[model samples]
Target: MEKKPNDVPKPNKENTISLEIAKDWTKRWRDMESTYNSHHDCRAFNIPLIDLQEVIKEQGVVSVRGYIGVEETVVEGDTVFIEKLIIVGVDANGKDMISSKDGLILDQESDDIYDFSDPCPNLCDPKSPLNG
Candidate 1:
């Protein structure tokens, strides 16, 4: 398996970004797209620490990785494409722990991929400074 999201050779507690940098990057995304932070764009997602711990508790999982993705959805009776963050378990070698069966390529619908994060704008902290 190859490291796709982080692109690192191995996992060792890296990939931490400062809050100010995160805020700026999020702000840039919000400013770059008109739909960002709006009904058409998915700004962020929230996952509980306890829930994330469950994924991390898997054997050989050393870190979690996230990938940007899009899904077909409808809002206000209109079809739309909203971005989402697809998180998954990463092994010590920095490879995604995607589940496979019978030696076949990983299926997109595999239950190992964690994509149930609560989307923002509808379920967000209105008072949080990170909402920008």
Candidate 2:
């Protein structure tokens, strides 16, 4: 009746990052941030499958791409522009796929940009085998 990390789906071997490697990389990032006293509790982003599906439903969108960004927010009373992952739809040409209702370049500000994915350390899979 309770969920645990093992409840999370196992990584696909095709492009999987091993548990050891993931831990190492995360540790490196934390170490660097700790030196500056800017350590964050976040470790990953949770992009739901349904949200990703919605992005790819747009015309000409063949895939989604994630970019690292920074935005000012308070963490334990410290204002910081923490690194966040922003996901955007990508067209076949590898361009950010923005839609035009009139089939033209102009569109509303809410076009195809997506963010606000739930960050980890809170939403992460508990005790995941992959060290999530």
Top of the candidates by TM-score = 1
lDDT of 1 by residue, 22-125 (tens): 23333444554565445464667877776677668777888988765444445676755444455677887888777556433344443254444467757788
* lDDT at residue 89 of model 2 (Cα atoms): 72
**Model 2 segments more than 4 A misplaced:** 1-38, 74-83, 99-106
- lDDT (10s digit) by residue, model 2, range 2-77: 3224222245422222233323333444556555334456677777777677666767778888754444445576
The ten-residue window of minimal lDDT in model 2 covers 13-22
Output the lDDT of residue 33, model 1: 53
Q: Kindly give the number of clashing pairs for every candidate.
A: 0, 0
Q: What lDDT does each candidate get?
A: 0.53, 0.52
- Using lDDT as the measure, which candidate wins? 1
